[model samples]
Target chain A: DAGVTQSPTHLIKTRGQQVTLRCSPKSGHDTVSWYQQALGQGPQFIFQYYEEEERQRGNFPDRFSGHQFPNYSSELNVNALLLGDSALYLCASSFRQGAVSSYNSPLHFGNGTRLTVT
Target chain B: QQQVKQSPQSLIVQKGGISIINCAYENTAFDYFPWYQQFPGKGPALLIAIRPDVSEKKEGRFTISFNKSAKQFSLHIMDSQPGDSATYFCAAPYFNKFYFGSGTKLNVKP
Candidate 1:
């Protein structure tokens, strides 16, 4: 069983540039969530996508958005990025079983993409 | 604001000693609490978890002690080994969302 996979292990961009990060959830999982982890900090929830729609979002600004494809893959887009946006972007996947919610499924994470905005 | 708080930003323990990390949350709606361990340049992995109804849950050397009344939970690693050294995070789930603590960096010396 292949685990969650993220592309572009490392990236570098200038301020005001846009960046797109991709993620492919683990096989047999349908829900995808994105998080940002700053240096020496815990991962912060960015948003979650289920059934091709954003189900829940964190306190992040509108600059951060995401999409869930029908295949269960996901893409996180950050427009006009700021230097502070530099951080490790992690993608987590879990199965949404029944009506109980995806929280019931333990999350499996990808290695994450390290974004450096200069 | 950080809904979940973790203590002792970092800790060091001798091999074969016990290592403990604590976390507290203010949200009462949280029912599931999980601990994650992460290594450098890698994502966090689920270590163990506990529900509010359960006082404790153990998996091998990792144990999760949950105190529902105090809204606090802790992770205890018994017979710590150098390979166990890493950053640990405590988290709770609210609705379909999850919140994480700042994390604790543990160093086990051989």
Candidate 2:
């Protein structure tokens, strides 16, 4: 079973530019959630996608958007980025139903895309 | 607002000692609590977890002690090893969304 995978292990973008990060959820998983981890900080929830639709979102602004493809893959897009947007973007996949009770089940994380917005 | 708060920005311990990190949550509705461990240049991985209904859950050297009334929980590593060093985060899932603590950096010296 392949774990979550992210593309563009490292990314560089200029201010006012747009960047897109990709993720492939674990096999047999339906829910994909995105998080942003800044330097010396914990991962912050960005948003979640379920059934090819966005299910919930965090405190991020409109500039941060995401899409869940029919195949359960996801893309996180940031428009008009700022320097503060520089962080490690992570993609986590989990089974939406009966997830918490499964002892062997936990959020499968990707290596992440280290986004550097200058 | 940050719903979950963790303590000890960083910790250093000798090998064979125990390392403990604590976290508290403000939301009572949170049912599932999980701990994630992250290393340099890597994403956070699930280390251990517990539910509010349960007071304690153990997995090998890792244990999660949860206090429902206090809304507090902690991760304990026994006989800590240098490989155990990493930043740990405590999180809770609420309303289909997940919230995480600030994080604690743990370093074990051999």
Candidate 3:
């Protein structure tokens, strides 16, 4: 089965601009999460989306936001992007079992979109 | 505070050697610990995972060892090879979100 897929493998934008990245989750997964990986660093959680609503978020600023659709696809929007926003934006999908409060599902990730802010 | 802390920012090992990466977590509530491997230009992929209740879990050459009292876990690669060279990340999931370590870059020389 096709795994999680992300759009625009690479992107370049200027500072103070906006960017939207897209993600299509794995076939059997219903939860979508976004992460940011800087060069030589591990992924940092941005937020997670389930049931079309943002369930949890990380320490990122308000400039970062996401949405999950009925089809389980997701979109990450960044406004007033800063140079620090330049990083690899990864999209991960996981199957949700049991209660929503306990989410220990392993994530399957996409290749990610490399964003560069000039 | 970093929820998950990984050790040895980078490592180099000879062929047929053993590679070990360690990680510690600050959250006692975290039960599920997972390790992910990532190649250049690719996203991290789940390699193996273990829960607090289990002291160890092994899959082929990969093994995860958990120390509940110390709040630490480690990934051990037996008989490492060049193909195993990649960035490794340890993560702890809490309330639908995962916190990842800084990552360890392992280079297995042949």
DockQ score of each predicted structure, in the order shown = 0.72, 0.59, 0.71
* Prediction RMSDs, each to the true structure: 1.0, 1.7, 1.3
Which residue pairs in model 2 clash with each other? none
Model 2 chain B lDDT-worst window of ten: B92-101
Ranked by lDDT, the better of candidates 1 and 3 is 1
lDDT of 2: 0.90
Write the candidate numbers in order of decreasing DockQ.
Answer: 1, 3, 2
When 1 and 2 are scored with DockQ, the better candidate is 1
Of candidates 2 and 1, the better by lDDT: 1
Q: Provide the global lDDT of candidate 3 against the true structure.
A: 0.92
Ranking by TM-score: 1, 3, 2
**Which candidate achieves the best lDDT against the true structure?**
1
* Candidate structures ordered by lDDT, highest first: 1, 3, 2
- Candidate 2 per-residue lDDT, tens place, B1-110, comes to 88999998899999999999999899998768999999998888988888788999999999999988888999999999999999999898886577888889999999
- DockQ for model 1? 0.72
